[model samples]
Target chain A: MGYISLDQARTIIAAALAHGGQLGLKPLSVAVLDSGSHLIAFERQDGSSTLRAQIATGKAAGALALGLSSRRIGEMAAERPSFVASLGTIAPAGLIPAAGGVIVVDEAGRAIGAVGVTGDTSDNDELCALAGIAAAKLKAQNA
Target chain B: MGYISLDQARTIIAAALAHGGQLGLKPLSVAVLDSGSHLIAFERQDGSSTLRAQIATGKAAGALALGLSSRRIGEMAAERPSFVASLGTIAPAGLIPAAGGVIVVDEAGRAIGAVGVTGDTSDNDELCALAGIAAAKLKAQNA
Candidate 1:
């Protein structure tokens, strides 16, 4: 299986932070995960909420576990709240089925992982994640 | 620097699980940790008893914290039971000195992460952990 290097993970996070700043979004925490949904790197801008890390990781994990963007996951969860709730139990750490998680694809067109951003509006977070993936020269599953 | 991605962690766990099955060991719970001892991935096979997750995590934590295999920790504890008992109090969640935890090393022999397995004899668990690490082409610290 493919993996995301630490350098690449850092680059993606830096771009995400820069994008969020450029857009004047709130202080944010960004997390990048390998294709298996494990965290490769994470950072929380000063003044961001402590919960931002958990939220960001959850979003990335959800995206990778489902092979879909968190936005799509949110849509499905909205239609089936009980099922989504069950999923959270299955993944004790939690899985946020919302916007802000985007799968990162390698040049070979294979998803290598995901990036999740939190502390801003879901749309803004999603935007920043997409921006980061693009800045890193990786593809975003949805963006 | 090298790091263990979520994909690699999952692959390691899958291999460990398969090895356990081949040996007819009891249901198991496995955990993977980054170099910092942060969780990367985890799984608890169906039928594994409760607390297996915590046990697995503790084992991994102990290995990462001391740079020694859980088996070695157990051996040291055998000689100084009180010190090991004190360690448990310090950890709160309890850090078992038993086997089943191994550090994952990069090609350069730098430890990149750790894996912990629980649910069978400590020796058997260690065997599975070693198998998993080998399958991933990563070195196990105390196979």
Candidate 2:
């Protein structure tokens, strides 16, 4: 049951903030989803717009449900708009197929969970996620 | 605003659970909707039925739109079935004119939002919502 825990969730969020601030990024919203694609914990930085929280959640859920980062899904979604549209209705809340999610992997390269970060550029979002994964002392494979 | 935060949302949910459990009630779903009828947060207990969350949200939205307690609306719905039936469709997204919603007020006696609970009798649902309101230090008035 060590897939993830509250402590790890907090550490990851802290890293997101520390790294994001170091880069002078805007306030961000971050979410951690359990293997079941349900929200474990989420934080919307003070003064961040309301939509950031919802978008972050969607990106994280997208990663877990598709078993891949939303960045890759974004390309596929663009090529197959119909598929993405239908899936939006069928998907869990906050499952946006975009470039904001990164797979949180374990030692065996198994995808254990995922993180979604928002409040900056798409590249910055991915970078913040990498920092969070590193701070958690777990492996992350960019997708 | 300072009237509510995620911490307040979590605390209100805890109050609802404490009240729901004491009555030996079925697992319940509780929702808090902000003044604009946007979902602030929601929770369904582990054993709650799947549709409970939708029911709870609908109830909260109904209260906010009508500016009244759902319990009072339930009474009117019983006598004026036609009005509620028409209302059910007039507003988008299932709005059940039932007694699971109660207004959440700020210290200034203004309705800032509502809390709704479902998965038990109407009385039980109202009980949990009231408990949440009281615990959150918000006014539960005119419902």
Candidate 2 clash pair list? A58-A94, A58-A95
Candidates' C-alpha lDDT: 0.85, 0.76
Candidate 1 to truth, TM: 0.63
lDDT of 1 by residue, A1-143 (tens): 34678998899999999998899999999999876566789999999877988899999888777778889989999999999878877653358988999888766656778899999999999999988888887788753
Name the candidate that leads on DockQ. Answer: 2
Docking class of 1: incorrect
Candidate 2 lDDT, A3-52, residue by residue in tens:
76656876787798789989999887777665666554556664566567
Q: Candidate 2, residues B53-82: lDDT per residue as tens digits?
A: 568878887888788888878888999989
Chain A TM-score for each of the predictions: 0.93, 0.92
Which candidate wins on lDDT? 1
lDDT of 1 by residue, B2-41 (tens): 7888889989999999999999999988999877566899
RMSD of 2: 4.7
